[model samples]
Target chain A: MSVAMPPGSAFLPLSVSLRGARLVYDDLLLFDGLDLELVGGSLTCLLGPSGIGKSSLLRLLAGLAPRGMSGHLHDGSGQSLRHQVAYMAQQDLLLPWLSVLDNVLLGSRLRGEPPDRSRALDLLARVGLTEVAHSRPAALSGGMRQRAALARTLMEQRPLVLMDEPFSGLDALTRLRLQDLAAELLAGCTVLLVTHDPLEALRLGEHILVMNGRPATLSALPELPGAPPRDPGDPALQAAYRAILRQLDAGSR
Target chain B: MKARLWRALLTLAGLLLVWQGVVMLGDLPPYIMPDPLAVGVRLWRDAGLLLGHAAVTALEIVLGMLLGTVLGVLSALALGYSRRARRWLLPVLIASQAVPVFALAPLLVLWLGYGMGSKIAMAMLVIYFPVTANFYDGLRHTPGGWLDLARVMAPEGRRWAVLWHIAIPAALPAFGSGLRVAAAVAPIGAVLGEWVGASAGLGYLMLQANSRMQIDLLFAALLVLAVLAVGLYFLVDAGLRRLLPWHPANPATLENG
Candidate 1:
C-alpha cells in the first residue's frame, strides 16, 4: 500500500546520521560519544527522562549546538543542515509585535525573500487560526499560540524539522488534535520531536529513541510499521507503548 | 479612564484646599508663599509671557530628549554587539554618573554659553544613563529560547538580520520604560541649566522674579513648569503604549476551528 501525501507537497526525504557528539556544559559532560541515526522521512520521537540531553542531539542535528561542540552530523545528501532545518522551541517565541500571519512568515522575511502570503495564509487556515491571523501573539490562547508556532515551523519548507516539546503545555485534547495536525502537515518531511509523554510518543513516533544516562546514550525500541499518528486507543499502539516503557526501564540500569 | 481622571482631579483639589487653609490660618504673608488664587491669577494674566518662555523650555527639553535617546540607543547597540567593548566601556559610563551632573551646569553654561545649547546639554546628560542602562539590560536579557529560534531561522552569519528582527523588538519594552523615566526627569536638566545662567526659559524667568520680589509670578512659573512636566510625561507614555501594542497582557482570543 502506498502512503497518501499532501497535494503539491513533494519533498525529498532526508536521513540524518550523528556521530561522536561531545556536548559539555560548564565541566559537566551532557553528551559524549553519542551517535544516532534517523530513518528517512519518518517521525522520530525522542523520549528521555529529565536531563538526558535529548535536546542537545536535536541542536547538533540542526547545527545549533554551542560553538565548541565537537561532532559531525550529516544528512542523506552528505550536506550541512545549517540552512536546511526549522526549529520550534519550547516557548512559542513568536515576535510579539508582529501579527500572527507575519510571525509565521518571519523566516522568509528574515532571509529577504518576499513573503509567500498565500502559502502563509493557507497554513494559517489549515491550523484553524484564520480569523485571528491579524491578532498579536499576546492575544492568542496557549493552544493557538503553539499552533501558530507549528505553522511557522512548517513555513520554513525545510526538509528537516526539530521540535522541542512544541505541545507539552497544551490541554490533553488540544495536544491530541495538534499531534494529528503535525503528522498530517509534516508527512513527507523528516522530523525529530522531543517529548516526555509516553502516550504522545506512541501516538506519533514511527521510531522510539529512548535516551538515558549522563553523556547520554540512545537506544531504539521495536516498532510497528503502521503509519502515524495511530489511535492512542489502538491496542497495537498501547502494546507498543508498553514495549517502549520496558525498553526504557531496562536501559536505565 | 474617566474614573482615573476624576480621582486625579480630586486629589489635586484636596491638595490646593489644604495649601489655601495653611496660608490663611498660619497668617503667612504672600511674599513667603502666594495663595493658590494669586498664583492662578498671575498664571492667567501672564499667559502670553509664560507661553513664550514655556515654548523655549519645551524646545530645549525636546531637543535634549531626542539627542539623549539617539545617543543612548547607539551606545546600547554598540554595547549589545561587542562584549569586549562592554567590558571596558560600561564601567566608565557608570562612573561618569557619580560626578554630580548638577555640578556640570556652570561649566556647560561657561563653555556652551548662556543659551539653549547649555540647557539642552544638561537635559541630555540627565537622561543619558537611564536610557542606556535600561536598553543595555533589555538587550542582554533577550530570552535564550528566542535566540535559538533566531539562529535556526537565519543562520547565515547575518548578525544584523538577527539583531534587527529579534533582539531589537524584544528589547523595546524595556527601552520604552527608560524613555518614560527620561521624560519625567527631562525638565530638571533644562531648568537647572537655566538657573545656572540663561536669558530665556521658565527657570530663568523664575530666578528673575525671585530677585525682583515678584513672588506671585515666580510661583506661576513653577506651576507652568509642573504642568509642562506632567503633560510631557503623559504624551510620552501614550506614545509608548501605541508603539508597543502587544503588551503581553491582552485577553486571550479563542482559536478558530
Candidate 2:
C-alpha cells in the first residue's frame, strides 16, 4: 500500500541559497566566494569531474562544510535549515547492527520521536526490500544496502536531501532502477544529487549544474522537458548527455 | 568447532603424559615436580576447600572487571572528546602503566587493607589501561564519511547523540577486544592482591601449600586458578560474540578489528 505522508506531518519544502561560501582545506582553495541556490521542492543534479568540489559544495549547503569556511547558507526562510537535511553519502552509512527497518527509523529515533514503523515498512516496500526488513546491513548485497540507505534518507522526512555519488557503486541495471525509484519517491523534496554519470544526471535532474575550477563555480544547464525518471533511451537525453560531457571536458581543461 | 575442541583435549592429554614420563625418567622428587596423578588426587580430595578459595578469587575478578570497564569507558570518553584531557590525562595514564603495575600490589593492600577491596582495586588497575587505549583509538578513528553523515543528520550539533549513536556503536568491537584482554589478565590482579596481604583466595591457598611443602595441593590450586582464567575468558568471548554478531567471525576480522 502506498503510504501517504500525513497532512501537516511532512516537511514544508525549503529553498536554500549560499552566498560567498569560502572553504579552503589545508592550503587548497576548494571554494572561494562560491554562490548557488536550490529552488524549493526541486531535484537539482550536480555533475563534475572526479575532484571538482561538487560534493564539497553540497556539504557547504548543508552547513557541514569543512572548518574555517566563511559563508552564509540562508534558508530563504531566514533560518537555520541544517536540521531539515538528510545526507546520503557515497558509502551506505547504515549502522551495521541495526536491522533494515530500524536503520530507516534512525532519524526519528535520534530525534526522540517514537518511530512510525508503518511508514518505515512502506518505504522499505517502495525500495523492493520488504523481505530483508529484519536483516542487518551486512546481510544485504551492495545494491540492497544502498537501497536500505535510500529508505533511511526518505524516512527522515526532511525537505533538503544531499546525496554524494549515492548510486555510483551499483551495477548499471540496479542504478537505473534506483534512479527511477528515487525520482518518484522524492517528488516534492529539494534534492542535490552529486554524480559522475552525465546520463544519470540527464535521466534524473530537473535542472543540472556543472561545478568546476580552482576556486569552484556553479553554472546551470537548460531544463529538460519533463521531471525525471525521464526516458534514459530518449534522443533528447542522449543529446543533453553529449553536450554535458563536452561541458565537463571543457571545464577540466 | 568440535574438531578444534577434540584437538585441544588431545594436546592436554599428551602434555600430561609427557609430564608423567618426565617425572618418572628424571627421578625427580615429588616436592620438586609432583606427578600429574598426585596433583589430580589432591584436586579431588581438597575440592571443597579449593572451591571456597576459587570463589573468592572469582568474585574479586568479576567486581574489578566491572569497575574497570566503567572507568575505562569514562576515561576514554574524556580522552576522545577533550583536547586538554587527551594531552594531560593520557600521559598520566601511560606513565601509570610504565612502572610495573604488579609492583603496586603492596601499596594497594596497605591502603585498601587485606580484604576483597584491595584485590578488586588491584584488578581494576590491571584492567583499565587496555580498555581505555583500545576504546579511545576506536572513538578517535571513526571514518570521515560516517562523521559527515552524523553531522548532516543532527544539525543541532548534538555531539553526545552523535557519539552515542555513531561513535560508541562503531567502537564496540574494539571495546570487546579490550574486555577480552581484561578478562585474561583479571586473575593476575586478584592473585597479586592476595599475595600482598589477603587471608582468602587461591593465591593465599597456593602460598600456604607452598610453605607447608604440600606440592600436590599447590599444583591443585594452580590448576584451579588456570581453569578460572580460561572459563572467564570464554564467558567474555561468548558474550561479546553475541553482542556483536555482525562482526565478521574470522581470524582476519579480529586482526583488523
Candidate 3:
C-alpha cells in the first residue's frame, strides 16, 4: 500500500546542489572540487566500489561534517538544506528499548515535539508492520526492522532523504520488496540512495551516478527507461546492470 | 527452574559437609571451630538479636545504594551533556577511585559519627565509582550511527534531548552492571565502618561475640552476613533484568532448567 502524504504541509521537493566539495582525512584526499546536483522529486542511486567516497558525499549533503571536509550544500534559494533532509543508514539504528511504534516517532520525541501518533500508525500500516508496532526492535526480523526504519525516515516529512545502503544487510527477496515499497512511499521526494547492488540501482534509480577514481568524481549513467520499481527482468534493466558492473569494474583498477 | 534450585541446594549441602568434615577431623574445640549444626542452633537461639542487627545493616546497604546510584547517574549525565563539566569533573571522578575507599572507613566513621550515618556514607563511597565509571563509559560510547540519526532528526539546540532519549537509555545495561557490583560490595563498606566503630549491626555483633569467645554466635552472624550479601545481589540482578527487558541475557548463562 502506498503511504499517505503527511498532513498540514506538502513537501516542497527541495533540489540540492553541491559545488566545489572537498573531503580530506589524515592528509589523504578522498574527493576534491566535486560538483553534483540532485534534481527535486527524483530518486538518484549512487554506486561505487568500497571506500570510494560515495557515502562521504551523501553525508556531506546531509550536512553531517566528515572531519576535514569542506563543502557548500544549499537549496537553490540560498537557504541551508539541513533542516529539509532526513538520513537513513545501513543499520536500522532502531532503539532496542523502544517499541516499534515508539521507534517510528523517535524523531519527534528527540526534537521534544508532541508526536503525531495517528500519522505514525498510518505510516506503519502502509509499511505492513501494523501488527508488530507494539513489539520491541529485538523481537522483529531484519526485514521488519528495516521497514520500521523506512517508516521512521518518512515520519520526518522532509523534502530530501539520504540513505546509505539502507537495505544492504537484508536477504535478496526482502531487499527487492523494500525497494518497491520505498519507491512508492518516497514517490515525490528527492532521494539520494547509496547502494552496492547494481540491480537495486536499476530497479529504483531514475538517475544513476557511478563514482570512480582516487579523488572521486560522479559520472551520470544514461537514464533508465520508465519510472522506478521497474521490472527487474526487463531487457533494458538487464543491459543497464551489465553497464554498471563494467563501470564499477573499470574503476576498481 | 527446579533443576537449578536443586543444583544450588546440592552445592550448599556439599559445602556444609566439607565444613562438618573439617571440624570433626581437626577435633577442634568450639572456640576454634564450631560445627555447622552448632552454628545453626546458635542462629535459632539468637534469631531476634541477629534480626535486629541484620535490619540495621540492611538499611545502610539499601539507602547507600539508592544515594550512590542517583549520584552516579547524575554525574554521568553531567559529564556526557557538557564538555566543560567533563573536563572539570572527570579528574575528580578518577581521583576518587585512586584513593582506596577502605582507607577512609575510620575517617568516615569519625566524621559522620559512630552511627548509621558513617556506615551509609561508607557504603555510598564504596559504590559510587563503579556506577559512575561504567555509566560514563557507556555514555561516551553511544553507537555513532544512533547519534548521527539524532543529529539529523533533532534541532542543533536540542542536543540534550539526544543525550536524554538516546544516550541514557542506551547506557542502562552498563548502569545495571554497575548497580549489580554496587549491591555486592555495598555491604563491605557498612561492615567495615561497623568494625572500626559502631554500637549495632551484624559486624558489631560478630566483634562482640568474638571477644566473648562465643565462636558459634560469631559463625551464625557471619552466615547471616553471607546470606544478606547474596540476597541483596540477587535482588538487584532480578530488578535490573526486569527494568531492562530489552537487554538480552545470554541464553548459555540463563538458568533454562
Candidate 4:
C-alpha cells in the first residue's frame, strides 16, 4: 500500500473498513459487532481508560491480534489490504545482550539479508543514539532504551505502523520529543497509536477514536486541528484536548 | 597481607580445634578421625603421586564439560529455534532426564570401557541437564521487542542475524547459570565413575586408602577433590562475570561469590 504523504500533516491514504469484528479471551468477550474505519495516511490516536480494549483494537488492525478473533479490513481506494504490518508492543523489549545498532539491524537479520549496518546506523542517528550504537540495552537509561526500541521499529520500513502505548513510560520531556519524532517519521506511513493521554491525542493525532465500556466498542472518532506536527501548546490543541476530556467525562458518568 | 594471614591462621586453628574436639568427644579411634596434622603430613608425603591422579581426573572433568556444552547448545538450538524439532524431540529430551546418571553410568562404562572415556561420559550425563535447560530458557526468553526490531530492520532473510544478534546473546545469562552448575558437578561425575570401576584417580585413591586403613590419605584425597570442585566453580564464575560485566551481580560482590 503506497501512502501518499499528505501535505502539512503526514497522511497515508487509509480506508480501513472493519465490519462486525469480535474478540474473546477465555470466555470473556472483549468486543462484538465492532465496526470502525480509518482514514488513509492519517494519524489515528486511540484513547480509553484501562481495560477499554484500545490496545486490543490496534492488535486487530495489525492482524497480530490473538487467535479466535475474527475481523475484515479494507485499505484505501476500497481495496482489500493484506500486507505485512509492523507492530510495536507496549514494552521496549530490546534484547539486553545486543548493541543498539545490532538490535536495529535485527529486522534485516530475520529476513536473511546481510544486515545493512549503515542504514541501521542512520536510523539510530535519527533517534539521537548514534554514539551509543554499540551500547547494549542494559547499559542504557529507560528513555534511551525506548528510543533504541523505536529505532528498531523504524528499521522495518512497513507501510502500516501500529504502536500500543509507546510513550507510556517516558517522562514528559522525552515523551514530547518522541511524539514529535514519531509524527515526523510517519509522514510517509499509516500510524495507529493507542494512548491514554488526552494532550498526546490532541498533539499527534489527526483523528481520535475514543473507546469505552464493556466489550469496548468504538465510542467516537473526533477530528483534531492544526495538523500534526501541530504545536503541543497551541490554543487549538488545548481546545481539542478539552473536547476529548468532556466526552470521556460524560461517558464515565 | 597481615590481616589476611591472621584470618587464614585463625580459620586453620579453629578447624583443627573443632576436629580434635570431635575426635576426642566421639571417642573415635585414629582410623575414624585422623588428626589434621597427620592428614596434612600424609598429603605432603603423597603429593607427587596424588597430584598426577588428580590431574587425570581434572582433565576428564574439563573435557566432559566442554563436550556437554557443545551437545547442550546444539540440542537447545535444534529444539528451541525450530518448531518442528521442538514438537518431536522436546518430549523425548525431557523424558531422557528421567534416566538417572547412576543408572546410565554403568551402561556408559559397559560401552566405553573403564578408561578416561567412561569417566568423561559419566560427567557428560551429569552436565547435560543444566546446560540444556539454561540455554533453552535463554533462547526462548529473547525480548519480543528485539524480535520485532529484527523483523523491521532486516525484513529479509537475516534469520541468522536473529541468532547471532539476539538469541545467543539473550541466552547468555541462563547459559552462564548452566555452566556454573555444570562446572560444580563435573568432578562429582568423574569421582563417581572412578568409584564404580576405574584406576588412577582420586576416587580409586580414596577406596584404596580406606581399605588399607590409611585414614590420613583418604582425608587428603577427599580434600583434593573438594579443591578441584571449588577451583572449577570459581574459574567458570569469573568467566561469567567477565562476559556479563553489566549485570548488577557482576559489578558487586555476591554473597556466594
What TM-score does chain B get in every candidate? Answer: 0.94, 0.95, 0.96, 0.92
All candidates in order of lDDT, best leading: 3, 2, 1, 4
Which 10-residue window of candidate 2 chain A scores lowest in summed lDDT? A1-10
CAPRI category for model 3? high
Query: What's the ranking of the predictions by TM-score, best on top?
Result: 3, 1, 2, 4
lDDT per residue as tens, model 2, A50-127: 777787777777667767677888787888776788899879998887899988887776666788999899889988
Using lDDT as the measure, the top candidate is 3
Each model's TM-score, in the order given? Answer: 0.94, 0.92, 0.97, 0.85
Task: Please give the lDDT score at residue A182 for candidate 3.
Answer: 90
lDDT for residue B239 in candidate 1, whole number 0-100? 88
- Candidate 4 per-residue lDDT, tens place, B10-109, comes to 9879988999888878887879888778888988999997898899899999999999989999988887878999999889889988988877777877
Q: Tens digit of lDDT per residue, candidate 1, span B1-257?
A: 68779999999999999999999999999999889999999999999999999999999999999999999999999999988879988999989989999999999999999989999999999999999999988998988887788778888857787788888988998999899999998899999999999999999999999999999999999989999999999999888877886755321121121
User: Model 3 segments beyond 4 Å from truth?
Assistant: A2-9, B250-257
lDDT for B232 in candidate 1 is 96
lDDT per residue as tens, model 4, A1-253 = 2232322233344557778888887888978999887666677888888776777677677655567687877675666554446667768877665688977876665666678888788778777898899987877888888788778777776666789899888899988888887787666567788999888877888888888666766765556556786787788777777887787877666
C-alpha lDDT of residue A253 in model 2: 79
Stretches of candidate 4 off by over 4 Å are A1-20, A77-84, A219-222, A229-236, A250-253, B1-17, B20-29, B81-96, B140-165, B246-257
Residue A190 of model 3, lDDT score: 89
For candidate 1, write residues A1-253 as lDDT tens digits. 1244452165688888888989888888887888888887888999987777777778878777775577988887788777778898778888889999999999887887899999898888888999999998978989899999988998888888898888888898988988898888888788899987788888899888888776678878778667888887888877877887787677667
Fraction of native contacts, model 1: 0.68
Chain A alone, model 2, TM-score?
Answer: 0.93
Native-referenced Cα lDDT, model 3 = 0.90
